[model samples]
Target: MATHSSVAHANLTVRQTLLHQLFGDHHGWLFERLRARLGCPSDAADMASETFVQVVALDDPHSIREPRALLTTIAKRLMYASWRRRDLERAYLDALANEPEQFAPSAEQQVMAVEALIEIDRLLDGLSSRARAAFLYSQLDGMTYADIARELGVSAPRVHQYVVQGLRACFEART
Candidate 1:
């Protein structure tokens, strides 16, 4: 029933003029809210800008009715991503500190490891304690199945099964 031009116009997001006006009106308020929630002014400002990036990428950003709510929600997700990054960096630094100084990994390897750590962290959420421990021992500490079994007081095959369960969870998350 809709005309092609009407559908095309509907597909268009916020025009430049409206985008500028929206930023001028809402950016300061959004930054303040993010600052209060994040407890860091610099991080809050960065997240507010990222929120506008998210808005501009939206398919129907002009359809938003509650601008403050929408901005805050987007900024909150950016804040979480920032926190996740910091956590990954800290963990990577700790891992490096424990390694022999002569065996430093390449930057590419470090980046991939950190990303894998984040993915494993996400996948391990909601798993039982034993299952989580099995995966971490095998993946992070580089323990053999027999070693994990001894540490966990379970059979070696059980530890293997636990690791498989964790891997299956990660695979399911990807698909």
Candidate 2:
């Protein structure tokens, strides 16, 4: 009487032997047909071996509609895999070719932009509340001076003065 472990071992051995037999018996026929279609021995052998391995692992290998039909399906799948790989390679090469070269900002430009921002912020902070709001509406929000005047219920001249004062103060701080 064999133990459960021994029975499982036997079943595995039997499956391996069946796989080897299937490969030996059908490999030549499968390879020849694939080679004729693919025009490459290495690819043909690989596809044919893969097909047998798939077929043997099936619960009912003998239930296949036709052996040649199954082999043809496997061959087509292999060709599709090769074409997909080629497509991915081409896309990668195209992306690499079209990418722009990377560069860091120049030190002078970085310093100038940062200094300008700081000066503008400082000037805005020093502004009277109403004047700062009017100036911010014109410069940052792109409102016209007349629009800022309407929103603040002030004269357009006052709005213009606020914007000019803010700009002058910013320039003075920067210098």
Candidate 3:
């Protein structure tokens, strides 16, 4: 029993030793070829190391018929990884470009723009039914609210209400 155990242990050790030798002997050759194909030395070396690590971890290491072909496949996978990284980088850069600048507008311009918007809202709110309808029709539909009331046969107030309710609902939904 001791002899059998000892022989099995020795065989396992030999197999590990053989794998290590094979890895070291082909490491540089594979890396160089990968580097030439990939156009990057550091990337090639990293990928080659990863490929050998994968090869040794497989259940049937000896079943691989062509080491060179296996290495090439690994290289292709690494190239795909590189492309994915680059694509993510491009998307990030594009998003960064569209980000708002971290600065306030000129105080006078900011105040003026806000004041104009407030006045416009106030004017819309203060209009009489027919007047407001006319205003909205002229502003939104390029028609006089008189025309809208004439078409709908309702008071201009009703038309203004419809526009206000629609606008209010849209704003509320957004919020």
Candidate 4:
């Protein structure tokens, strides 16, 4: 009879074997598919690797019946996230471009600011467009509910609700 440690080791070995087999069977196909969609071999390779990483995080990889469909879904989500981050960074840089040289952030500060923005974006992921806009306008632009309502073409109470919803999302994300 196997000891507890031996049984755990055997289970780990089995999971590793399954993961290796899955990677070997699908990595090339996924890489080529991504390459075709992205038009960049390096980006395709990175996306394929990230896709497998997501698979590895699954509780039961063996239960997947349609691997390609799952891989495509995961890759598309990653691609969208990448595009969003790039857009955020570009916008931040454009804003900074208008600042005087004396007030320009250092490279490290810029990186930290971008990372913080990404985290904020993740925290606000499920908010509606108006809710997000209301929250940003209120918090960043110092707009009142009346002003936000006028800008969003909604009632002041509705703007208040949106701002509260945005705050709730951020609070839940923190916890």
Better of 3 and 4 by lDDT: 4
Top candidate on lDDT is 4
- Locate the minimum summed-lDDT window of 10 residues in model 1: 9-18
Q: What is the lDDT ranking, best to worst?
A: 4, 1, 2, 3
**Candidate 3 C-alpha lDDT tens digits along 92-155:** 4465457675644455755564555344444455445555555556565777556787876777
- C-alpha lDDT of all candidate models, in order: 0.85, 0.75, 0.68, 0.94
Q: Write the per-residue lDDT of candidate 1 for residues 1-175, one digit (tens) a residue.
A: 9999887676553376667888999999998888888888988888888899988787766688988888878877777777887888897889898999888888898888888887777788768889889998998799999999999999999999899989888889989
Ordered list by TM-score, greatest first = 4, 1, 3, 2
TM-score of candidate 3 versus the correct structure, residues matched by position: 0.49
Quote each prediction's TM-score: 0.66, 0.46, 0.49, 0.94
Q: Write one digit per residue (lDDT tens) for candidate 2, span 73-148.
A: 8768767766655554565446545756454345575456445544455567678988888877988789998889
lDDT of 2: 0.75
**Model 4 misplacement above 4 A:** none
lDDT of 2 at 96: 46
- The residue ranges of model 1 lying beyond 4 angstroms of the native Cα positions read 1-3, 10-22, 36-42, 58-65, 123-133, 142-165
Best by TM-score: 4
Clashes of each: 0, 0, 2, 0
